[model samples]
Target chain A: MTTRTGPPAPEIRHVTVVGCGLIGTSVALALRAEGVRVTLADHDPRSLSEAVRMGAGLALAAGEPPADVVVIATPPSTVAAVLRDAQARGLGAVYTDVASTKGRILSSAELTGCDMSTYVPGHPMAGREVSGTGAARADLFAGRKWALCPGPATALLAALTVTELAALCGAQVCLLSPYAHDRAVAAVSHAPLVLSAALAARFAYTREGADVLALTGRGLYDVTRVAGSPPELWIDILEHNAEAVADMLEQVVDDLAAVGAALREADGSARWGVVADLLVRGNLGRELIVDAYARRAPAEGVELEAA
Target chain B: MTTRTGPPAPEIRHVTVVGCGLIGTSVALALRAEGVRVTLADHDPRSLSEAVRMGAGLALAAGEPPADVVVIATPPSTVAAVLRDAQARGLGAVYTDVASTKGRILSSAELTGCDMSTYVPGHPMAGREVSGTGAARADLFAGRKWALCPGPATALLAALTVTELAALCGAQVCLLSPYAHDRAVAAVSHAPLVLSAALAARFAYTREGADVLALTGRGLYDVTRVAGSPPELWIDILEHNAEAVADMLEQVVDDLAAVGAALREADGSARWGVVADLLVRGNLGRELIVDAYARRAPAEGVELEAA
Candidate 1:
């Protein structure tokens, strides 16, 4: 396999993106904008056509490509299968998968006897409320953190090539073990989805909640926005990262119990103290997240309306 | 007390606003912009001076206001006490409040033996993340719902006068029982505060969460935006509405348990079905909120950025 080096080199030529969904289409658009030859492929013929129309790439039939890099941006449950199929078909010199849960992808790839060295398990920490090729943007990954889980066969040249790809898309690249990546995303992303779904379900069962819906404000909108995500996508995510998500859910249960006990005792002081502690900690957590994004790419004057 | 009908007879009359904080300052600005005399009052000397500089009529001492309408914009914990104190001093001909939790406000006013007829338990469903008079904006309440919890002494003249006040400030008037208002807000507003706080605390307790913080995206940011709200304010809200909040919390716990169990069993089919049910419900809940807000005042061109 040919290797590329340095900044803005002619090393990167043709790129093949296998899924043609939101993330895959987005990656293809970003690459095409950088003047790379992009090939779009998908089991769904409609998605492939949509990706092409969205400027992701030209529709390509299944076969080996004379491309430098291949991106597998399918759902978590299908990531391993797509990776194996692409590798067996000799799709590209270097390949990567943009599945949220990385550990499962790597494990499944191993079970399928796919080459690990030539493959990188990656997760782009960026997305929108909407899905499909329609939501794909060339700058979607700009200034966001992209986690690259490089296994043993991940040559330094190949890893650097992926990093360059991320940088070209204006994203910051971070390295982590596949296990660590999956666990971290489960805690921050997957667990929040589950928690939000639970909250919405709770409101649905309450008589007062009907009235609450009438009085809804930005507070509720912010907290439950993730609850509106596609349910099937979340099911795939939760099933892949079940252990980590369950652990977080149990912790949440303990916290809720303590809060309930404090409120039950009618100790205004204790209740306030407990609730205040949790809120302050939440503020700190949020600050940490904001700081991370600011470091990667400053928001650059995105004015937010007052809450 | 002399009550005049038909829009204060076009007189440049003074309007006294108690508390001189975020809501009060905003109200003062809104009223003053309409060429009305606005006298600001606050126990805090600093807030009093700030309100005066912000175009409110001369800062009044702690005495009866020589004005027509008085708006009490103090914190929930202090709403009743302040109203009672103001009424005892014969502050104004008609009075109202902007406290968030209303049932407790009325109950406390009753305990203090204040004339309910003269005081209206009002809450404007609008705010900013930042607090204090400095953060106040004249257009803060524009196109938002301003709920009026009228009492027995809520004469038609006074109600009409306040309704005109709401219209002048670009807000839609909503009248409901204080109890119903409290129940609605607890589910949509107060309950989400506790839920977000709990999620934040749980995230902070995990090592993987530390890593995830650096990879945060818009989803996490939107979900936890309210988690940054001042803890003291939430404590007061939750303490006053503990029973309602407790009930909501219990339902959330039940839902969480069901979701966790389904995922743990690797029951993808069941998990997907359950989450689909929740997503559908959540979509319904969101649509109801959007429609209500749109009906109150069409949000045709409101472009709010991510919080």
Candidate 2:
């Protein structure tokens, strides 16, 4: 029952992905499946060679023509520099970077004198615990949300091309501003990383030993599952969105302290109000997050909610 | 590669379960599968009838002969009272409970003047989002840890009988003391519940609306997954183990505050040390918890680690 109600789809015949990581290779493989020619590049020759071996795409050769779109799939810190270099080389008619944070990257790209009109900053809400080109799969973005945060100067053609690229890779589009994107991820993603780590860190310091660990159930397992992620990668992500994440973390700390105080109060019965309030809110919030996916499942078109 | 070095199994011909909730019914069903006659009881007649309909067991009849073992599967707050009443009625030769917390129930059971030597307190490390007999499964405890926290006065026969019961239900046994079990769960289960709720509560109050909700990925979803649980049930759990849960929550608050400060500091590069330390510990702790299960899989015998 859901339908797309915009202009005709832009033709994306050739695309170049700057980093042959999990996301880049997955994007290349996905587009290749749809008959779009994909060119791959990476600072590490092994990653580029592995992506090519995995049938993702051909390695970008020297003196190549400008492609329809160039995707910067590097880490968050390097996205702006890569975007500037790609634009300077006239790599594509439209440009986008698949970075987790948006505001910092957008501002840095602007500072580096990149053409903002041809750039549509985006992030795909799909990933695995493992990384690199070897772990990439074409179906990684099959049913995930691909967020497109376009600047005011971003040309409509550039936005349309990126949206079509997301669609071709089997993802729905979420439209929001750059600042909104960063804040949203800080609340949902970056903040949870620190929270999960904090919870798991308790397990590490416990003098009670393995028996204490033995008492663990599925709830603890699920809550701290992401705690085992590589620290270097998470540190970088947290650094870019530090302020927003710190704000969310402080909010969590306040709530935790309130609940802790309630639990330690002399009057046992009175503590229920403070404890139950946060829990009820948590239940409601969890439903909101879960329901978003349920509502978006049928409507494959762009969800146009911006800051 | 794993072998049992215990005495020959105890002959448990019949069993009586006092509460016909999810865990209680599952225990009865597991014993029934082992060719033991089972009798089920619940304060709610509807629950008793439903358990009977599901072939968990026959409903408890007036003046029935005492069974080999009695399992109390009531809520955490009501467990001690149920144990006292069951003991007064001469319910069975051996008695045990499946409450999540231990020290409170054991002390209360003693204060209420119940027989101490015959009772073994247990907690199955298994549950589902839904509760009650309707959601009960025969294999709910399969491959899960069933903690048996035997008091100093608890007889060997009583502890052995409960361990055998756990084995019959396809569970591995982890033996610890009452206070230790409470402290362990405070770290793993109870504390994680509050933490998950605190994380999810942010989404409930977000002014950014559905667009921010749409930005949620699997990481946030997994972290806050249990936040949707019923608050009344959780409040009761926290209240019973209030001090232990509060202690762990305070530790979490401290870690979060430190990380938040590090993120907000003026020096950008120096923050990695504090942030990465917690993440690395979190990684190690997660491995410890995961490895506990992996290590237990090959050995079905009791894991004898106590405080």
lDDT for A169 (candidate 1): 67
Q: Which candidate number has the best DockQ?
A: 2
Prediction-by-prediction clash tally? 2, 0
Q: What is the C-alpha local distance difference test score of each model? A: 0.75, 0.87
TM match of model 2 to true structure: 0.96
- Writing each residue's lDDT as its tens digit, candidate 1 over B231-256 gives 77777777777777787787777777
Per-model TM against the reference: 0.90, 0.96
In the range A1-307, model 1's lDDT, one tens digit per residue, is 2243344432777889888878999999999999989998888898999888877889876554556888888888988888888877888888888888878778889899888888878788888767887889999988788889887677776776677677666676788887777767876788888777666655554555545565567777778778767766777887788888888787777777667667667554745677677777877776776665466663322211110
